[model samples]
Target: MFSKSCNYAIKATIFIAQQSLQENKVSFVDIAKEIDSPTAFTAKILQILVKAGIIESVKGVNGGFYIPKRKIKKTFLVQIVDAIDGDSVFQGCGLGLSHCSEKHPCPVHDKFKSIRNQLAYMLKTTNLEELALGIKSGETFLKTL
Candidate 1:
């Protein structure tokens, strides 16, 4: 499971992606509302994403958060997760051990390995444009009804 910050980051990223097609930028308040996330927490997450170069921010009357044209090609879900929550979620032991490895496997190590690999693949391969298109085409749903 992802942490609250990760969840918010994903939501904010998707919202920005969806809006990118229509607008070059969006306000933090707008993103928070669209994702139903807390404004303060979402702001912090957005800052982290910006710092990670997963998202871009500008300051001015018309300035706000937006995905950089260049980053749209290089950034992936894993980077965002790493920026906000660190790599432990993806690399840590599945059974919450202090240390886990092939020689010291956890109870669910084998079972979790396949699933974890698949998730890593998806995160590494998927980018904001692909996710944005999914949102626009209804292939993905961002908000809960």
Candidate 2:
């Protein structure tokens, strides 16, 4: 599972992507409210995403964060996760064993392997634009279970 920061980053990214279609930019406060995230935490994640080149930002009266429609194809969920939580979520052992590997497999290594591979594939294949479109068209569902 992803961390809170990663979740916040994805939500904020999706919000920005939605806004990019109409608004030129969006303020941090507005993004936080839109995604129901903490203002300060979302701002930090946005800064990280901007620094990673996954999103853009400007400073002025009209300054805010926005994802350029041009670079949408190059941005992936993996990049956002890495920018916020590093590669540990994808690379580390699912069973929490420090030495788990092919030769010295953990108890749940084989079972987790398939799930991990699927997760990695999803992260690599999904982009902000697709998610944004899903949001706009109501193809994506946002609910808490």
Candidate 3:
């Protein structure tokens, strides 16, 4: 449902949030490993998240990445999705038509639109805090293992 990079971003952010609740900073290697993503790609995604103000990076021998306390609840999943994948997921056609729209609908346009609306609603309403809590409680996870 999301690009590989966006998937990694969400996973990494949620993991970082889970760590932040315990007042811990996570290194790039740890984040990548926890999310099952490539280290170099995860580093690049972290750069994007930092630039977008969704996460913070500290510079020092013991420095690492963390989401700020102020942002823990304020940062919604949509923000991360937007920062990494832009608004394309919400705007583009499910059928991959260059000009698909209500005016000239694709075969699955209406159904796709309904599904997209639900996805957008979930993304906008679900904050990282809730997801982190789920992870902490063992109700959810970044990876199967």
Best by TM-score: 3
lDDT of 1 by residue, 73-112 (tens): 5668888878878876677788888788889899999888
lDDT of each: 0.84, 0.85, 0.94
Compute each candidate's TM-score over C-alphas. Answer: 0.91, 0.91, 0.97
Weakest lDDT window of 10 consecutive positions for candidate 1: 67-76
List model 3 lDDT by residue over 53-141, tens digit each.
99998988878999887789999999999999999989978989999988999999999999999999999999999999999999987
lDDT for model 3, on a 0 to 1 scale?
0.94
2 or 3: which has the higher lDDT? 3
In candidate 2, list every pair of residues with a backbone clash. Answer: none
- 12-111 per-residue lDDT for model 2 (tens digits): 8887887786666999999888778889988888888998998999999989999888777668899898888888877768878889999999889988
Model 3, TM vs. native: 0.97
TM-score for predicted model 2 compared with the true structure: 0.91
**Who wins the lDDT comparison?**
3
In angstroms, the error of model 2 at 126 is: 0.8
TM-score of 1: 0.91
Query: What ranking of all candidate models by lDDT puts the best one first?
Result: 3, 2, 1
Q: Higher-TM-score candidate among 2 and 3?
A: 3
Q: How accurate is candidate 2 locally (lDDT)?
A: 0.85
